[model samples]
Target: MSKKDYYDILGVSRDASDDDIKKAYRKRAHQHHPDKAGGEEAKFKEVNEAYQVLSHKEKRKQYDAYGHAFEGAGGGAPGGGASSGFQWDFSGGGFNGGEGFSDIFGDFFGFGGRGARRKTNQGEDIQASLTIELEDSAFGREKEISLKRVIACDRCNGSGAEPKSETISCTHCSGTGEVRKQFRTPFGTMAQNTTCTECHGRGKVPKHKCATCGGNGIKHATDTFTVKIPSGIETGEAFGVAGKGNAAPFGGTVGNLYVSVSIAKHPVFTRQGDDLHMKVSVGISQAVFGDKVEVQTLHGAINLKIPAGIQSGTIIRVEGKGMPRRAGYGKGDLLAVVNIHTPTKLTRRQKELLEELKKENL
Candidate 1:
């Protein structure tokens, strides 16, 4: 039988870029991986074989020019001779001196060619939330938050050893923090170095464990700390505090704490970006004639002049009376919407006055 074309196998065009070929290979490999559900082992090997030739510039150039005849010219096919037929070899130096293939496998499979170690020293990050009033955002304030997190053990000083105890190298991995193992997959046998289970990748064990923390180097505790909320901070904005998260075991690097702020809804004022909006009620007479009215703002109540013959729903801009500008130096304006108050019930004298005004056309 004739061999299939490499481009057709990868489902890519003949002029596909190097990046496009790599992406296609990853997609095909993931789809046909033997460990996945409904995976086809033979198709998986075919995809790997196709990627092996196309990913290399020189091999790809030869394959494009000579087609299957390139293999007869000893273009580094599976075996030394072209008649030996094609085979998948993932053993020593099979993938471009192993670096490129190692990176590709490490990204998707979480394991590389050899000497791949899992990173466990860094502590996990913590997420928290803080609720504040809208007024609090107008003016910055410091708030105290409480949360339970992992902290370094006080008794061991985060060393996982007693005050005078001695430290010794791990016997399982001989201080290398990793152990070599061989895995048999559909492609071939793969050698992978995994983290040593006995030492947990630390490569050391305390001769005498700490009494309080039992050599864990960490403890669970409820911590309280103050966080500063900046002025004009919007809802859902997050601020980070360094070194306030969980502490790594055996005194490794500490993670960060991210706090998301949420602003409570105000009963009177509505915030639009940096601008504050509120409705100010005016009497019918006040709307007909000019009048000064007290308007509520985030800062305080201020006197706002109502223009003569002002119509209902008219917006009056009050400069420098809104929320403080979070990015710049100046404050935003407060928009006051005018609402005319119409009396539902009228007394006899009020009705008579309206009758006289109607007759005069006022």
Candidate 2:
């Protein structure tokens, strides 16, 4: 039987870019991986075989020129010598040394097939929450927070050894930071390089353990620091403090601290994206006659003009009286919604004046 087209196998066009071919391979391989539920082993092998040919530049060129005839000329897939009557020289360690193969399997299996390196001793990041009042958000404030975290050992200076101790190469990895590992997958036996468990990728071990931290290179401690909360910061926004998190073992990089901020509800004002809304009650006479009234704002109380015969729920804008702008040099306007007040009881004189006014059809 004739072999299938590599482009058709990966569901990609013949003119597909290298990135397009890689993406298609990942999608098709994941869909047919034998270990996955409802997966087809035969389809998985076909996808791998197709990728093995098209992924290489020289092999792809040869296949494009001669199609299936290239196999007879020893241009078949890697490691397919003699039995398939074709072979491609991979002295540079084609599948084992190339980044493309390792990266693809890393995405699928969570372990790079080969030549994968990782920072095993890096510290872990920390997450925290901070709550501030609405007024504080309008004016920006500095806040102090406390946390219990891991710090580098003071006695040994994070070296994980006693003050005068000697160091030795890691026997497990023979002074190499990584160790060779073999994982059996549906594809075949895959050789991978993983961090040394004994030395945590440092490639060295302490002859004498640190007394302060018991060879861990770190100690538990409480930390307190001030964080500057910017003005106009919205709720659920986060800020980061570099190097304020846990200290790495064996003197690796320190982690960062992330603080998520939340603003408290204000009693009088409600905020909406740089604008403040508040209710301002005006007397019946003031609404009918149009007068200047004092309205409370974030900065201070300001005089607001009430138009004559104004209806309730009318919004009066006080420019530059709201919260400070976090991004630029300006302040949002304060919107005061007017509410007309009607007296439930009236004095005799007031009642007589209202009665007379009622007769005037007002």
Candidate 3:
């Protein structure tokens, strides 16, 4: 099907109030909400799309610049699902009677809450994948990440109206914000009750529009937050950043952020579960005669004693040289696999001595 004019579908005007758009959404969502038996999910989504666009400042600017038919340029319509392959489920508001609008609108837009939200509901948490070094992950770290999203426009404060301005009665609905249209069709005079286009079913209009945010309270911005990662965190582990997710519309609480960790690969040492692994090379004489050697670890080099007559492929354990275990448990041990090196060439006397020693051993 062809795309419907966003303003026409929502019964709003080129310049409508946020309250107007909200009332429009509630009206259509009530009728087209999936719980209504004959309701259409697509129509309900169209309503959400209209709100997501008209309610956000950057999106509204793009819509205003391109007139609701804005192409996403190269990327598509941000996260509104207007890009393509969008799904619409309507079980919110009084449509489901007990269902919430948040679920239905969330299918397209990322924000949470519908109409008005009560206290509680810790807000939705968002997960982000961040790559850090083992040193950083081990000792705890602070990092700044850039998040591109729609937040409340600093200029309008989510009201979408100019500050110090007032709202007056709507002209189209005669203060009802709704109107019943009567048209003389081929059959007879057909009448339909729909939201008013002039005031968007709000029954009011702002006397002045905000110049900074253009009367739309939300702005498209790059939000940067320095996330603090706790020590002793393992790879692929997750952390939380409170109140960092999408901001709730209509003065609701902000959402949270979740970050997934990825530690970098070490050059000389390998990690397995909390233990470190490394290869140690020793001369043939030292392997056979037992010697004390210095081993490398994350902290520093430590001395380890090798047993007499030790052979190649032998593993030596150095306790407490690995990563700290979670839950305050004991740390892991480092395993040093020994490799015995042989002399490639020897003098006549050395060769004679080696041959005599080999014969004696035999």
User: Top model by lDDT, which number?
Assistant: 1
Per lDDT, what order, best first? 1, 2, 3
Enumerate clash totals for all models, in the order shown. Answer: 0, 0, 2
**Higher-scoring candidate on lDDT, 1 or 3:** 1
2 or 3, greater by lDDT: 2
After superposition, the stretches of candidate 3 with alpha carbons farther than 4 Å from their true spots are 1-124, 156-216, 343-362
Model 3: per-residue Cα lDDT over 1-362, one tens digit each: 12666788889887888888889878987888655888886676667667666776755665666652333223233354444223232222222232233232222232222211122223345668888877675557788888765567676686556888887777778888667754332112323344565555567756676676565455667898798876667788998888887654322366788888888897767778778788888877798899999876777888878888988999888888877776686677788888888888898997898999999992
lDDT for model 3, on a 0 to 1 scale?
0.65
Candidate 2 has an lDDT of 0.76
Deviation (Å) of 32 in candidate 2: 14
* Count of backbone collisions in candidate 1: 0
User: Which candidate leads in TM-score?
Assistant: 1
* Tens digits of per-residue lDDT for model 2, 1-362: 12778889999998899999999999999999777998886677678767876887866775676665534433233354322322222222223343444443332221222111234677877988889888878888888899988889999998899999999998999999778665443355445556787777889989998999887688889988888787888899988888888998887788888889899888999998788999999888998999999877889877899999999999988888888877798998899999999988999999999999999997
Give every collision pair in model 1. Answer: none
Candidate 2 at 152: error in angstroms?
2.8
Which consecutive 10 residues in model 3 have the weakest lDDT in total?
A: 112-121
| CA error at residue 37 for candidate 3, angstroms | 21
Model 2 alpha-carbon miss at residue 97, Å: 24
